[model samples]
Target: MSEPPKERVKYIDTNLNLPYHYYAGDYKALYLRALKDKKILGSRCSKSGKVFVPPVIASPETLAPCDELVELPHRGIVTTFCVVNVPVYGREIEIPYVVASVALDGADVSLYSLIQECAAADVHMGIRVEAVWKPDGERQGDHTDIRYFRPTGEPDAPFESFIHRL
Candidate 1:
């Protein structure tokens, strides 16, 4: 006898409210707290001599634990970037802004941030930029404390200066 036909699967759409809380551990807690004061904190791996911004507990490249935390400057080079022309949900900024990988001075790894205060066309790899921080009272001890990075008008960084971070 022939077997009965199998049931066909149907798809349904639904929305669920998922509430969550994030807890930044010791290292991230220190990093986020520093943001409230407009400071960038980085951790250095003694073994590899590499520094990481948004400080991680261990070096990603060397798998070595980092105990030395240092403050980093806001200035950096735009190692790479992309101009956003598309819109997405929950986007707080307008389109046509440049999002870039910034290699802050003294940090071995590059940090990502929005590039502003200049035309998108003016943003290019190796451009020198500085963080534009929000007022101290307005800081929330988070990434939002940094409004954006703007051109410093300094000469572009030497390729050798930031090429490794890229």
Candidate 2:
């Protein structure tokens, strides 16, 4: 005899509210706190000598402990980027803004950020940009303290300068 048809699987659409305290452990706490001063921080891998921005506790490449703190320059090179034509929720930015992987000076890893103060067409790999920070009084110990990165009009860095971070 033929078996009865199996029930179809179903998914429920539900919204759950989750609120909790975010604890930034030592490595990240230091990095976040430096944002208030308009400074960027990185953690150096003790074994590999690589510096990572928004510091990680360990090196992703070598799994070595990152125990040293290093200051990074807000000026960075755009390793790669894309023009966003779609709108982001809660952000009032005009469409077609640029987003990029910024390889800050003295850091081995790159940070992702919005690129502004220039036309999207002008943004390209190796373009030099610097952070635009919020006014000090409004600043918090958060990455948001840097409103965005804008063109510095310096010459573009050569591919060799940031290719590893890409």
Per-residue error at 149 for model 2, in Å? 0.8
TM-score of 2: 0.87
- In candidate 2 the C-alpha lDDT for residue 153 amounts to 92
**Local distance difference test, each candidate:** 0.91, 0.90
After superposition, the stretches of candidate 1 with alpha carbons farther than 4 Å from their true spots are 1-9, 12-20
Top candidate, metric TM-score:
1
Taking the tens digit of each residue's C-alpha lDDT, what string does model 2 give over 1-166? 4875587557887899999998878878888888988888899999989998888889988999988888898898999999999999998999999989999988888999999988999999999999999997899988789999999999989999889997
RMSD of each: 3.0, 3.8
Candidate 1 residue pairs that clash? none
Clashes of 1: 0
Q: Estimated TM-score per prediction? A: 0.89, 0.87
lDDT, candidate 1, 1-166, per-residue tens: 4875587557776889999997879999999899998889999997898999878888878899989999999999999899999997899788889999999988888999999999999999999999999986999998889989999999999888898897
